[model samples]
Target: MFGELTNGRYVTLARSDLSRLLFERIKDTTEIIFGNEIVGLEEKSDGVRVRLKHGGERKFDLVVGADGLHSGVRRLAFGPQHQFEKKLGYAVAAFEVEGYRPRDEDVYLMYGRPGRMVGRFTLHRNRTLFLFVFVVDSDPLPTALKMQQEMLREKYEDGGWECPRILEELGRTDELYFDSVSQIRMNGWSKGRVALTGDAAFCVSLLAGQGSALAMISAYVLAGELLKADGRHQEAFLKYEASLRDYIQTKQQGAARFATALAPRTQLGLLFRNLVTNAFVIPGLARLVIGKEITDAVQLPDYHWQSSVI
Candidate 1:
């Protein structure tokens, strides 16, 4: 089964079709089980035996943990996220700020030197998303919401440049996503028959704006590798890790560097950032730098997907 794109708008339907589509093309019949969480796993001569939370057991040839950020599977298979996650001393909080119109064509970027930046991006339609990220040196996440509101009032209260309008909207929205600008690093993506994909394996983090793309690419490659191994699951897992390892590492490095550039700590860093953005406003220069920067970050290989199960 396939999903049809919604008329006159883009819709996210992949989550709905994932499980059903995977089972559709499989040829040989296999037992399908659900609602059981694997609590323990052991290596056996034949394969791996997994213990379930519901007092159940199953021997599987392979296990894939594609679960996101705080992944339970990763904790079981690899170590813990905290061991690999690097905190950048920055707090990011974002919520929808309504009635803030920056442009009819594209989003607005507001930048300042003091480790603060606000970007208003137009979403699907009629609504804008406000993203504010700052560097506060200490544990800034606790009072992040309240601080953001104060910062908003102070920075934008008297501004004639779309800032006042944006502040008005920011005051109304209470919900937000708050976190440290961080990346996940894993030396290996495979352990025995257990494999990982997406954020669980390696998180590109928020600053690079490549997390979503990296996750999609990782999923596609992992699935293809599994199919290519021809039921030799260990080989498939290793191959998948080998292929994507370098790519993921490179992306993580890039994200770390980018986080620094976005919220530079030094006075020279602030001056440099402002000078660059302000000077590069010329259409030609702006296009050259911004285009090349983003493209370099997101550049990845094409993994063609085909159904071998049938």
Candidate 2:
């Protein structure tokens, strides 16, 4: 059991840490604009004219909507979010705790309750990340951070384990990132010179645990296709979609079902889940349940070298 399941191959890093590392690498080569956001886009024959919220405009040969789940670029180019966003009947609120130490510093600690989950992840020696996810039945979801915090407190106030202490700390935390668990599904990810990437195009939610990997793959394929097309965006966009759409759609389908199983809705379900994982999540069974085949559903193409990078 230990030999089959103990193979070390994956590394997990905080999203902020990864972003900061990438930004440092590209800060010198790219003209990065901070604070302002895209407000509008007008497609033309040669390029797309983009309007920022600060009354700024720029024209580019391509616009990749890597903005995220509630993407402004997706809205400007595709349409409203409701048309494409599929709510998974859950919400997650996340905050960070500085100067905290855990016994197992290298491992992720998680607990699941009926329709709720609380987890702690170590970011570094001094920093820890906390996340609280719960089932929700509300639409027109709460948008304000205060409301999200209040809702999390109200929902998990009586929760067992470390939730109470986490909630207390959450009160003092100044920054909170909250959003409904949702997947964005679109008939197509591109229109004219603009294309969507990452959470903007297809989100497998968090339950699938493949959002970041899939996004990186999307970026690589999109860039490769663009290089293959020699700056011809229409052709590149078509190829990108054709190449990855089926794989993403298959993963998205799995995510929708996995979300429910993540934090079961009933006590019996949770018990069964615990029993199954404890019994089967070992040795050859673990591989059967969750293996490389599931993780590597998409085969990445070997790309030729291109002078330009995205």
Candidate 3:
């Protein structure tokens, strides 16, 4: 299975090919409107009032709040973030770098801290993506890459292949994303007809390397539930929540554990990591720690395309 990615994300799929794949796979009549920000939601007897910015609004059979973390629709329907989100006290920012590689490098390299980890991976054919994450107190605000560069240098500057290189290249990109990795644990993700989906329902901290997968899978399930509802959006929302709750809970719990792994606090923590990494020779110990903890006793689900689902 592929690992999770955050920064400098690129997909190898060519523009036309990617568009074709998406169209063929999801050939529903679901119209996608861009740049529309949801400002408010008022539930009606049969549907929900999906109010958009600049006074545009619409009614839908179902309003799935897939807006993402800091979900605008979430607050409009439920409440503020404080009502659901629990911050783990860390944040991250990621962006691409300049000419740091051979201009043809497409492999990945990464590093980790107790509360943070960074990685890079192949996008498609020729481009490489860079990702960076760090867990810090305060906001450190570092505010910008120049500050992050200073900070990274203070911590891991001595003789690294890319620490310095990354710092130098940090100036090239103006599209950096920053946010805290907190989990959303709600007693109920649905109220009347408006329901939360994806990161709105449960944000499996990026620490678990499964945020994107969860988003994709959760959306698929939600859409399926809607189809099953046949028109009963509320029932579908509740059923979707009930069916996916256990999995979401398990994944979030795993994310908390991952946070600990990234930032080992003690000598024992370091030793424990090494032991797990080398557990093959230790009899049943591998099965005890690494297997269960890392994998969560769960295998990645296959998402092979079936002509029917689309």
TM-score of each: 0.71, 0.92, 0.75
Over 177-292, each residue of candidate 3 has an lDDT whose tens digit, in order, gives 66666888899988777788878888877666666567767777777777677777778888777777887887787678766665555557756754555555555554455443
Whole-model Cα lDDT of every candidate shown, in order: 0.67, 0.82, 0.65
How would the candidate models be sorted by TM-score, starting from the highest? 2, 3, 1
Model 2 misplaced stretches (Cα beyond 4 Å): 1-7, 292-294, 306-310
For model 2, how does the per-residue alpha-carbon lDDT over 1-310 read when each residue is reduced to its tens digit? 3335436545676677878988998898999998899988998888889998886798987889998888899998889999998999998878888876544576667788889988887776577888777899877668777787789888888888788888888889889888889999999999888899999999888767777778889999998888789877889999999999888888888788777777888999889877866876455786676554245647788886755553
How well does candidate 2 score on lDDT at residue 216? 89
Clashing pairs in model 2, backbone N/Cα/C closer than 3 A: none
Worst 10 residues of 2 by lDDT: 1-10
Model 2 residue 179 distance off true place after TM-score fit, in angstroms:
0.8
Tens digits of per-residue lDDT for model 1 on 85-138? Answer: 778777676777445555544535655445666666665546677776677666
As a TM-score, model 3 comes out at 0.75
- What's the CA RMSD for each of the models? 6.9, 2.4, 5.7
Q: How many residue pairs clash in all the candidates, one count each?
A: 0, 0, 5
